[model samples]
Target: MKRKKVQFGVMLHGPGGHMNAWRSADVPSDASTNFEHYLSVTKRAEAAGFSFVFVADGLYINEKSIPHFLSRFEPLTILAALAPMTSRIGLVGTISTSYSEPFTVARQLASIDKMSGGRAGWNVVTSPLEGSADNFSKDKHPEHSLRYDIAEEHLEVVQGLWDSWEDDAFVRDAGNNQYFDKDKMHELNYEGDFFQVKGPLNIDRSNQGQPIIFQAGASKKGSGFAAKHADAVFTNGGTLKQAKDAYKDMKQKAVEAGRNGDDIKIFPVLSPIVGKTREAVRERYKEIQNLVTVEEALAYLGRYFDHHDFSQYDLDAPFPELGDIGKNSFQSTTDEIKRRAKEDDLTLREVALQETTRETPFMGTYEEVAETIITWIDEGAADGFVLTPHVLGELYDDFLNEVIPILVEKGYYDTAYETDTLRGELGLKFKENRYTQKIRV
Candidate 1:
């Protein structure tokens, strides 16, 4: 049999972009709070034959340190609103296991899936930021290991609740005054390490059974959890080799957990800054760079560096010699910068600019970008990509107009969405996957 074509999605962020994405004058700065902006983007994505539009969630903002768009509408609420506006596009949103109750999360997601006619997806995340704990009324954030532990159990409860309502559970016979079939509804009766969720979900099972589970942690515990549960894994891979290795590792882990390795769709976040020519792309990149301030960059860096003050260092300085500052503090960030700097033969200022810009690895003309994406997919580095636009409307419009047709022509992506439900579009086995295997056995 011939292999199936790859898939793709747009990873939407608040206020039109990520980090310094707003610096693009073409992006709407007010998008974080504006429902109309989200509607416009989702409609465009759907029209472009994109797989889905993903929304990331963060509860609090470090106002003094970073200019993040934190006070926007909640992910679930926003997704629900967008569901009514568009019919076929998937709506995936982040919900942290650290703070939310499984029942609440399960119910809300199920409701959205139903309301949207089964186009909802839940991106499960155990928030890494310690500051989020404060907003949730906790004195301190749990350690990383502990958070994953809770996440494992939290996922079990949520999945169980979703399964509580079987396909035939809702009959709604008006003549008999019967709304549901009691025998088909199963009480979850789940008692786990972190939570005790009892009985069936209040809502009926969604069109896709349970909404697709999206996960994005690359830590050991995270990978393990994703292997066991995630329908799609969102990742950040800087190189084709790195992405391939990560995808291989994730599939191996999934097999060990007794799930089909191919079931886990790997999507790496690709931030592409495209233009008609290389110089035009470079110029556009430079224009965004000019908007970044030293203070803003340092504030963004401070979150990972813990004890260090980036403001004290020269803006154009190379890697600082931190003598025994503890490898735990920003080690990954520092190492990545060092590696990229050497690989690209970049100056310290260039490295700084790259960090602030957070451009997608694939940056060039439409044809070049399309070829690069196809190369990654062919290499088994990704099943698809989660595109993060550097500029909001313009960036998306450019890619949709320029790159999408190329992908469709190359037989790498869909010319049109094949299914209405988000889960169906992603090719996920909605009803008979690993979650139902245990019962079948």
Candidate 2:
């Protein structure tokens, strides 16, 4: 097979990435909690040579929790279940640092690595939902900077625990009744502002070394954190220029942080609503939008705008002049929405409805979608696309059957996978154990 030039990962947000996905005829309404549904998607992607399947999770859920958010498999549990079933495609799970303990996450991911034969990745997140703190016995979610701080320390502790034992730590020497080399075990003794984890992990380092780190941070602090630590970033660049700029910024930041910039691959999110023809694409797009009622669209907007119920405001009127930096939800999203609304002079209803019809890679024929993705990759705007199949069943199949062929024909996609590990497939270096590095030096 030709050398793989672009990396691709899939994120199935339960039934689908779209808010109205469950209502689509192709998808099962109960797909969010169904194991078979999840497995089928992963198996399909693997057959098509996709790089990874990411199971995203969150702690907070309310009336507004969309189909996937209302009830879905926790990321790690789902990935663990998928580990033994699939062989080549990477299994990446989203984990929030704010409400989790480092040791627990570390052990679980290590187990996933072991179970999957080293094809495991961790998509790290700092939960920013306003009510997420309530689930973990707190009054409010920690402020943005503080959450990132906790995230940085939380990851430090986890990585330290991962490196607790050298690769040669376990011997299993039965002749002398000696199980392992005692000198190979190293204590973490990690004392950070947020945690004080005192020793080695119960399990040894995984086959791929540390689990590959994946992050999707759009804010300055969030992007900086990713540049410093993440192996790959599921980037959020709203446009081509934005994507290129963000990619450059991350690579530069990585270089400044004393790491090879190219080691951090940036995958911009892609949602392709494709059809056989341009008219069919538009028709399908309209159908998806029609399923979302105004009430639902308002609720969706409310979630993005710091939980300020948009229902309380005039839908046809311009978005209220709420200046940036006053919300507990996603600062970057809120700011972007505000900027777009202001620039276009869009009504609240228009803004909310537009968001409801979340389409990316642009709605068009399959060939058009494929061209857009290839252009982005070739132009340095992205390493590849983190595809979020809006409605899983036929939508995902169409992409695999249609768009991939164009890419394959254009010599932009490989006919076969290059490596078993996600790190190897993405051209990332295996993480070096701290103690092992010291010994070599």
Candidate 3:
């Protein structure tokens, strides 16, 4: 069978792509806390014919550097405000299964989908950081395996709640003193290992029945959960071969779990710092790098992995042997760095810079950047990409004006959005509930 065409999305945070993105002189530093900044970016994305925009979430700030990382509006609240501003792009917001209740999450997501006319998406995450657990009244984070188990149950309950009120369940008929068709409403009464949720959700079913479910997990258990439930999966593989391998494995896992392999879309995050010329791009990258303080990088790293005392390492010297960082906490990142260094014959300092930043070969002329994305798509490495702009609005503007036309001409991207609803744009058909089994008397 012929492969499907690639889809595209943009991942947005404070001012732009990553935590250090604010350092870019062109990006407004205060945009992280400014609602108008978000609105501006959203308008740009919608006009560009982009598929969606995503906002990530975290529950707590790092104890060591609270000042640097803690100033952004909550994702769901921001997305709710964004719902009415745009007409076509999907609005995805992350919510932690480890900290939120099933019913509450279901209600919030459904409400946003309704408010957006079916353009909401939920990115389910099982946070592994310990600080988040402390905020949730737990002294320690749960084991990774146990957390995945809870996520599985949580997702099932949420889906059940979303389906409780069937389409046409509410008649709003007042003449006959009948407000609803009682038979059309069903009770979930879900009893599971991690949670017990009873009955139908208080809110009505969304226009799309449920919000699109996005998952971002790459570990063994994480990949499994994503294959079984995610409408789309976000991953962070740095090489084409690695992305292809991961995508193939995920599809196989989905098939083994009795799901259609094509049901789950794989999107890898690509942070491209584009410019009109290679020299210009390099100059821009250097400017952004200069603004990153060691303190800020270390603060961001400590939150995601082991708490490294980066202050001790010389800025010009090679990274010291990472002998003390917790194996479970930083193993994947360390392994990736080591592999890339050996394969590319890069120095330790260069490896550190690459892993800590977003500057890459994708940062060149418009033709060069577009060619790189087309190459990746043709390689069967990903269904599409989640573009992470290094500077607020600049990368997006450049892409829309310079690169989108090329993609459209090559028949690799859409010239216009197919529908206002996210589900329709994503090619998801609304199907009748198949979980209900019939009894043969």
Candidate 4:
């Protein structure tokens, strides 16, 4: 039997996860738009038997987008292209339900599922960005509660569309003069508070039935929505204790919603910077930090605090007091900024220019890093991890080469791919067809 292991995935948001990594010379400045460079990274991840690859997206961008957000490939299109280049590894991409038609979005995701042979996953995002409404011909974005409401219906419609045809719906039989089983087909004549969709989808279910659904929600409504629907939840936890509480809360909420808690995976987001020794880790960490100026870092804060411009405040002063913000923006991140500020008694400058050192969570020698990751899994703080690297090329290679081996030896990581489907690899069940009832009738 394959060893029971801790699941892991690589999160590629632009060139890398760290905003300042784009300024680092080790990363090619145009890596965001460079497909060949991205292909190499994907190949490396696949070669190393990593569980999945993810791409985050946004529809709107302004001056604060840094480099990667300013320009990059659209998530679905790029994921489809990567399909032919690899096998077995999962391909997940982000799409905002708030900005898309369920039918069209369903079609696109179903196509990727077909292309990747059951290795497709969708990160269902509800909000687009700060000014995404104007691009969609609306003067204002939907409020927080309203967007979640739309998202709830949006998921229902999309999954219903995916269920348009049953698993055995298609049959090519020349002798009987038949092409498809009519009785096996289903029509989703669905009308919800937010949308009305009439869908007998144009595509069949891919290898895994439908693409696996992923969510990255930490707010009240967002968390509930994920517990009820998502196969997995991506999150942030600065410490082992925080991760354990988060993991328990999500599982409990899932159980409360009448679902088995194990069906949902909790992947805490971590960006590990490892070294042979603590000194080596801090030195390399400083190099990436020095690349971005204080002014640039403050501008970076604008993405989270959508309601307030931190640049207008005194840098040396305590992180400026702000009212409830990001209700229509990144609510969880905004809450985190406030929480960290109060906890650390930090200045606006310190908050903006956050850096990793020995005292930080995921920065340390190989042994220390491995110990913390294993503890999170054992302590029920995390089911697995969605790792974001500071720099995609060198730093990613370092973790794969150095840190993962340690995890495997300690019995917390797997040495090879145990399953072909993304759902199987992530230990999630295939989504049951909702339209199965319609077809039976």
Candidate 5:
């Protein structure tokens, strides 16, 4: 099957994606806060023709929080720092609507878009951790469904602010002493249930117009929001079957929401452990599994369940019974964990270890891993993937030198960038300012 080119984005999870990655002797323990480490890795990814670099974020952390989460660069700040350093690769960073103002979020992203020559993307999210409310000065976290309701309105306001100025508003005619066309400028006097923003945004539009919108909403309400608004959707893509189901469902939802199915791209996270041989791959995986104790695994699992103390239950016994406990925080992920425990009859110890050191389908010899990736794209399971390597230093190098060459040779992936902006590279259209369209109409 002759398929179109597949896109790729790397997740910049310092240290690595594994819970105990920081403990490895090869990985720098302070990689989470080391700017030089990120700079070097980002430059390498850019040279290898990655479409973007994604920075995931969180608002709150506890004693049980992962090492990277305990101390990490603020998403937007790091993206901004990386902007001038890289040329073509998109700079995407997470920002939560639950605890941020629309005007501020809109302006900050627009600044990055302008500075990066239009290579900016915003990953919109609603902070799900209950402790986040404490940080934001609230009595309790918003209910699960209500948070989505707030997110819809919050995103609406941000988009409206982004369209405040038309394309030709700055008609810099110095001789005539005309700095801008007053008639072309528009104000977004938006008043939604959650926010009210009256703005003729201080900053102007970039070449790609507004920054690209990315969302990772896997719950029913969350997925609906993504279908309606996001330029791309991030998913877990648990297996071949699951990935296909998610891709088809998301496309259908986008069509139903009055958008073209191709407008929204699906990118599942793939944390591969690559090696020259199958034995090497097995050894690498075992090294990662041995780094974490069972106690640490249980703690890692707790984060998804709103920090529910898994230690209270019998580790060797069947998984504990808890209904609607994690509904407010990471609902879909928590539900899946519960369902799998029941379905597979896994004990608490088994489930915890499995979640902490889970192996992906993209693990094997270089050629085999390359084939699996190509199969997913050719089979319509994914538009692309977001690589979060299990072993950053070695696996990333292995993928770049080994598997990537195979994908490039087979005509499934490109080794050079085709466009300047994130939207252009992703096959998405440049967003026109709303005011400009109104004037033409």
Candidate 6:
């Protein structure tokens, strides 16, 4: 894969990503629902030259769900609302293929692309929680592999719908009374196992023709879908070696799927704790960790295991034995937690705290955090990063003010917004309409 400039995306979780973030005095009580708060944060990110702002979504929630997940704006709706407000920043939102119809998802995303001048991205997801099926009025959720099969067909139909109209299809001419070129219009007429969409979409293509496709693929089946379809991958970064292995595997899969290795950029999540000094950073980290109790940590860990009650286990005993509890939901993450707990001989309480406040790779001064980021990208461990503001307002502000400038001086980042579209900012080529390609051939 060819080397490219590192990119950054800010992942927003209203008050913060931490479980006890809402308890902090610095955070607004209604930050998650406050449109003004969102607007302010996005504008700051845009000004700081971040590549995009990502909004994660989940359909079903329970009493045990995290604070941020319990109450948050829907992804597509919020992204659309943010489109006209900001000009250059990309808007990426998560929408599950399991519950949503391709036609509706396609139209909503395409509308955002048009509204943002082609600065839209869709993070394709298969609703992992089994309870999601209940909310959708389905008897049972599709199993892991079956969900990917549906995702494959769902994405194909959506991309097909995007190519409904050719690039020069619209020709508004009052004198000739010609609104659009009829020959350029084409119907998808797609008939798949999961979906059967017909005819051209009502909305025309956007500036980039299609919205960028993003997927978070950790399992075998999930990664295969992303390798073939996604333009970028949002992943979790474990360690330098672990990240490198995943990076290499993803690039190889993309090549085997008949795409350039560089076609699908790999972005692992970067959640750093940055402060003015090492002492200050350690103090802040400890303060944040103390916010979440042992019970809360157990609940947070249970979210990956289909909400399995971890409170029943003895706090001082070894990690419980659950053969395949989390294979369907967040397989990679669950597997890692189990493997690490067993390998390190961690007690139940130890595992809970460690998992809750997982050690951040970048924890120190602002300069040190910047250096770690450069090392990760330069070492082929990552192409870019999905920056998670673990403590919303405070951490995010520090990163944009202190760390980003160091990155700029070191040639790993730039502050100027030269492109209007997300694809251009990420150095990805515009997708040409399939109908237009047929005409040229």
> Evaluated with TM-score, which candidate comes out highest?
5
TM-score of each: 0.91, 0.97, 0.91, 0.96, 0.98, 0.98
Q: How accurate is candidate 3 locally (lDDT)?
A: 0.76
The lDDT for every candidate, in the order shown, is: 0.78, 0.85, 0.76, 0.83, 0.91, 0.88
Q: Best-fitting candidate, measured by lDDT?
A: 5
Clashing pairs in 5: none
What is the RMSD, in Å, between candidate 3 and the native fold over all Cα? 2.8
Looking at model 1, residue 258 earns an lDDT score of: 98
Prediction RMSDs, each to the true structure: 2.8, 1.6, 2.8, 2.0, 1.0, 1.5
Ranked by TM-score, the better of candidates 1 and 5 is 5
Candidate scoring better on TM-score of 1 and 4: 4
Clashing pairs in 1: 271-360
lDDT tens readout by residue for model 5, 1-441 = 766787889988888888778888767899889899899889989999999999999999999998778999998999999999999999999999999999999999999999999999999999889999999888989998999899999989888888888888899999999999998777888888889888988989998999999999899999999999999999998889999999999999999999999999999998888888999999998998998999999999999999989999999999999988999999999989999999999999999999998877988999999999988998889998998986568878888889999999989888789889999999999999887777679
lDDT of 1 by residue, 1-441 (tens): 444576777866755554655545666676677788788888888888778899987665656433446457788888988888888888999999999999999899988999999888889988766667888889987877788899999988888888886677678899999998776777878877789878677887777878999998776777888999999999877878889999999999999999999889999888788889999999978776677776776666555554246667766756555553423433445555656767766654555556767666688999999999888887889988887775676768898889988888888777587877877888887764333456679
For candidate 1, give the lDDT of residue 224. Answer: 88
Candidate 2 lDDT over residue span 363-399, tens digit each:
7898888888878887789888888877887878999
Tens digits of per-residue lDDT, candidate 4, 294-393, equal 8778777777766257778999999887886665788888888788888989998898888321135888888888888877777788888887887786
Candidate 6 per-residue lDDT, tens place, 80-164, comes to 8999899999999999999999999989999999999999999999988999999988999899999999999999999999988
What is the clash tally of candidate 1? 1
